[model samples]
Target: MERSLAIGPGCRAAAAAAIGLTWLTVAPAAQPRAASPFRLHGTVEPIRSQLVTVPRLTGTGFGPLIIIHLAKPGTLVKAGESLVEGCRAAAAAAIGLTWLTVAPAAQPRAASPFRLHGTVEPIRSQLVTVPRLTGTGFGPLIIIHLAKPGTLVKAGESLVEFDRAAQIKTAHDREAEYRDFIAQISKRRADQIVARGRDETELVEAENAVKTAELDLLDKDLVAPIVAEKNTLILEEARAKVAQLRKTFDLKRRTEAAEVRILEIQRDRALNAWKHSEGNADKMRIASPLAGLVVLKTIWKQGSFGEVQEGEEVRPGMPILEVVDPSAMRVRARVNQADVTRVRVGQPVRVTLDSFPSRQFTGRLEQLSPIGSPSGLSNKVRTFIAVFSIDGSDPHVLPDLAAAVDVDVK
Candidate 1:
């Protein structure tokens, strides 16, 4: 039979305290142990296998085994492959922990890799640009004669000679005109002097006639009254004639001076034109700045683009040749943006000639462009230009030769 038992509050509290003590004593033993906080994630690289290390054990029942296993040549290893293994007791005594590293084994490469392709160029060069003949009033000139391509020239030598026929004719014509104007100016000066002298003489004569008429009016006091009045009118007429002559003389002098000035200006213009034409005609000859090998520049010709020839007619201020110093040589290379950061100025470099594969040259990285530019037609790819100055010169190491540059960079 089920029976209900009623207990007092003090008795119930004593029973609950007893149950709490039992749980507190057992909870500590029931929790799980914590996992390690440190873990490493990486791949196992196949390396030259080697022996493992073990320390001497004290009071141990078993001795550690030291095994040496070297992987075979061309061996490939996967991740998690055991490189070394040791007993926990031995590892802790030897290294406080257990890990060892070995470099990879070497294998035969199928082919040699290429670092970069570049072009050979001269280190020092002078571009024989078109002279500023146009600024000297000889614009739009045509090239009559030019030095042949690949011609070796010396300083002060004529590299290019322009056609000066038109300029020469203009100069001669202007000179002739200038001379004519000079002669006309001289004649005008003499004629002006003669006209001025004649005006002065007429002015003097009119003044003297007025004085004589005044004297006659004074004498008219002894003659009839009508005669005196007539004398006074005569004097007035003389004075009016003198005033008219003076005005006409001034007008004539001004006109003569203006004509002389006009003649002088024409002469000056003609003389300046003649001098400008002469100077331009002389500037038609372009001289070389230094002694070097001359290379012709390609220009737009009659219908197509080709090298500038002697017979080709070229305008003034057109570059027709480049003088390159072959002794000083260099290589221009374009390094991809991915590899540009690996290259630095003043670093040593090795260069190989494409034509002469056996020939290798040593040079220093002299220049590196800080800015990057798009390569070819692809805007997505960019490259930096690097210039290397060749250490020494070789006869076969000419400009425009294909080459390869090897840089030491990881």
Candidate 2:
């Protein structure tokens, strides 16, 4: 039972051969490995965006604006939609309001091929603001009505309505002044006409008296010495009166013309002021220039920065809101200098939103920055900015969302 059997030399050789073949097959399989693709992080941003601000009025006294109504944030809108409304704090009543249209400039398309990180942005957007009033002094603007923020609107829709009371009142005052000036000018002209007629009659009478005096002088020689001297004196008096009347007529006409000219100038100034006020009143209401979503700007208020609200006063030139086109969005990404050369414009890439990992978008490189900035890691290293355009639309593909981009080097 304990007896052992010895292996032959041929059997040992065969076992060694089998082991070598298995090693060779496993080594080859382990030596070859697949490389991972390069990825860059970026943020979603609107390609076109405008800052909304209070308009700078040309004349003085427009200040301390009060918001009466405001649009709810995140509204989808078309071009010309109403966004915000305001009025003057001192306004007593509302007046007829009109809409103002804004237009965005066109953006040129570019291509990029790289993985980079950037912000989401609309390709086009516009800033909504209170309109500037020219040629008149208006009081502070007050918000009367505002479109809900983030509203979807079309062009020509009302965005904001400011209290038109101040503008309307100013217009009325200017109009009244203009009309009064017109009446004064007319009355003055009529008075001048009556005075001219009276003066002409007096002048003619004086001339006739001079002629009568000359004829009477011819008879002076036939009369007594005292009578002749008296006739000569009468003739001299008539000639002197005729010369005085003629000079007065010319002076009066010149003075009256100058007076009328002054009134006309005043009337023109009043007319211009009235027109400016009327236009300003219409401008009180702000409208969307393009179809997009409404975004309210964060502003400093009461020692902190926040979105503007109804009944809050805003100064001229202060930022208030924005209308952004959501359809066309892009991501601005920063790429390492070393990887910059690997990417080119027009290269296809995959974009994944960090907020929603499940959502992935296909896009292409739109642009690459020519210059590079110093990297955080080292001064010698640089990073370049690259823009990628998302191919299609998604409700969640809004601006400012963080995204990961995978560049297809192959």
Choose the strongest candidate by TM-score.
Answer: 2
User: What is the C-alpha lDDT profile of model 2 across 326-405, one tens digit per residue?
Assistant: 89988888988768878889988899988998999999989999999998888977899899899979999876778989
TM-score, candidate 1, is 0.64
Q: Among all windows of ten consecutive residues in candidate 2, which has the lowest summed lDDT?
A: 19-28
Candidate 1 residues 1-410, lDDT tens each? 55444434445456756544222222456667697698899998745655445545555554555544443433454444445544455554543433444445356343332377889988777877665652344456566778887788888999888788977888999999999999998898898888889889988998999999988987776999999998899899999999999899888888988988898899999988899888878888988888878887777877888887665566656777888887788989898876776788987778999999999999878999998899887897789999988888787787788988887653
lDDT of 2: 0.79
lDDT of 2 at 398: 79
Return the number of clashes found in candidate 2.
87
Question: lDDT at 40 for candidate 2?
Answer: 100
Alpha carbon lDDT at 289, candidate 1: 83
